[model samples]
Target: MLENLGNRFQDIFKKVRGHGKLSEENIKEALKEVKMSLLEADVNYKVVKDFIKKIQEKAIGTEVLKGINPGQQFIKIVNDELVELLGGTNSRLTKGVKNPTVIMLAGLQGAGKTTFAAKLAARLRKEGETPYLVAADVYRPAAMKQLEVLAKQINIPAYIDEGNKDPIDISKKAFGQARANNYSYMIIDTAGRLHIDEHLMDELGDIKKAVRPQEILLVVDAMIGQDAVNLAKNFNDKLSIDGIVLTKFDGDTRGGAALSIKSVVGKPIKFVGVGEKIADLELFHPERLASRILGMGDVVSLVEKAQEVVDEKDIKSLEEKIKTQQFDLNDFLKQLQTIKKMGPLGSILKMIPGMNSDLGDLAPAEKEMKKTEAIIQSMTLQERKKPDILKASRKIRIAKGSGTDVSDINKLLKQFSQMKNMMKMLSSGKMPNLGGGMPMGIGRGKNKFF
Candidate 1:
């Protein structure tokens, strides 16, 4: 999402590292470039100015200028400042002392508040919390229905007051129902408009007063740039929002709203909507995001994501299969599905150290995975278990069923053979050849992985 800004920062750091030593002039020149990059990224003018100023003060100090690695020291200073600009630490959702903590979501009509509500409920549900979705958006057509459907997808309960038109009344009743049912959390999806208006504010205020929510999260679209920051300020002025939920963070965002909102509006971004999936919501972490923006990658977050989707027992089973040479196409398909559950391949690659901005395009890799899945699905269980029995005629039939050329099927089989060979070598404590022995469609031929 912050690809451009991240690239610029990485370029600037590369130039700094190229120099044998850094002087005050070197620091000044780099900070000037950094300032321009932030401005070009659509960051708020005041926020950019203050950020550059802080870095300048820290970089020019004797502690940094005389450090053994001045370039690295300067980079650390910038990273620290970026973390502070991004809110210094993670802001957790508040849970009141009483039961059934209530959270109210407010934002523009298309800001993804409804979708984020479902995402949040899903996250809480995974945490062993009984979360109930309160469809209080009585204004937008089908808003309640939309929340209900999303809730059903995650197997969470949702309250919809079909007869009630008042959002405040609906929220109050939903809160009562949640409390009576002993739900751990009640997330109210409030109505929004094209823009902030007095009526919208009044209605939200009435709901807040009626429910007395433990937290009021203002959902801001990260793709809107500085407008999102201004919107946050306006909402905070009217409703005193507790935290921010930056939605569409996986879009082609310039990174302005994410960098400026916390500093300008004095609100911590609690969660970020990384994708459209109900499991795509991530708790916002300032240091991890700061590292990503600097092209440092976020290994901590990567490992956390892996832990969330990869089961230990499944891993052990897969390991035993590989060691026993019993892995088949079915097991390979299962591994592919598990990888898909971790989110997009491109986003996953960006989280690895040293793989930050180097991945040019990942479309081919994604397409290859989909094609492999199609071919495997087209094959029968017996074929997956025993690929040796398949001849040219069977290959042609499978290709036709999967809507691919026979050559594609050949390449997939070749790739699968190479993968199995590599696994065999590893299991036998031998190193596999890497020159011409690499998997087809991975780093060789026209169908590169990236």
Candidate 2:
């Protein structure tokens, strides 16, 4: 998500590390590059200034300059400061003492308030809360319908008062209904204007007054750069927003909003919309983001994603199959599906410690995996279990079914055979000959093999 800015930071660190001993001048030069990169990423100028000042104070000190590994020390200082600048810790949703915690979302039009409301509702539901969605965006004709559809998709209850145009009244009634229904949370999606206006603020303020929401979150389009920070400030000034939610965070954004919102608005980024899927909403973590930006990877988040999709029983079964050399095409296909469930291949690889900057175009690799999956799916169950039984006639038939050539089938079988042999060797405590590189299309190539 912050690929551009992250690449820049990695390059700057590489230069700093090239120096055997970092002089003050060398450190200053690196910091200057860092400052320019932050500004170019559309981070707020004042935020960048304060951030650089903090780094300089720590970086030029005797502890860093006299350290055995000055370059590593400097990088650590920058990472620490970056984490603090980005809120230092994750901000969780606030729960009220009473039943049905109310969360009101506010933002300008096209900030993704409606979608984020549904995403948040789904997340809360996954956490065992009976979340009720309330669509109060009366001015927007489609907002109510959209919320209804999303609520149905997530199997959550939604209150859409199409007959009533008063959002404040709609919210009050929804709150009463949610409480009566014994809902754990009620998330109200308030209306928004194309630009900030007194009327819009007044409507949102009235809804907050009527609902007495436990949290008032400002959803912002992260692609809007510094304007997002300013918008959050304006909303906080008028309505006193509790936290910020940066939507479209997966877009080709320079990452200005996420880096600047906390510093400018004095509110933590409670959540970020990574993708359009109902489950794409994620709790913002400052330390994880800092690590990602510095090319250190986010192993904790990657593990969490894995744990969510991979069942314990499935892992045990797979391990047993590999041990017995029975990890056939069926198991291979299932593994592919599991990886796909974790998210995009490129994003998953980026979670590895050193894979961030080295990964070029991953589309070819992703396409190859899909092709392999299709080929495997076209085979019969017996063929998957006993791939050696596929004669010329069967290969021809399978090729036609999968829309691939016979040679493609041969390559897959060859790769699968090598993979099995390698697994056997590993299980026997012997190192397989990796001189031929990884099997399948996993080796380096012009097409950027999977």
Highest TM-score: give the candidate number. 2
Candidates in order have lDDT scores of 0.88, 0.89
Which pairs, if any, clash in model 1? Answer: none
List candidate 2 stretches off by more than 4 Å: 18-21, 61-68, 443-449
Candidate 1 residues lying further than 4 Å off, grouped into runs, are 61-71, 428-433, 436-440, 444-447
lDDT by residue for model 1 (350-379), tens:
887666776776887898899889998999
What lDDT tens digits, residue by residue, belong to model 2 across residues 265-383?
89999999989898888899999999999998889989999999999999999999999988999999998999999998888877878666667888888987988998999999999
TM-score of each model, in listed order: 0.91, 0.96
For model 2, what is the C-alpha lDDT against the true structure? Answer: 0.89
RMSD of each: 2.7, 1.7
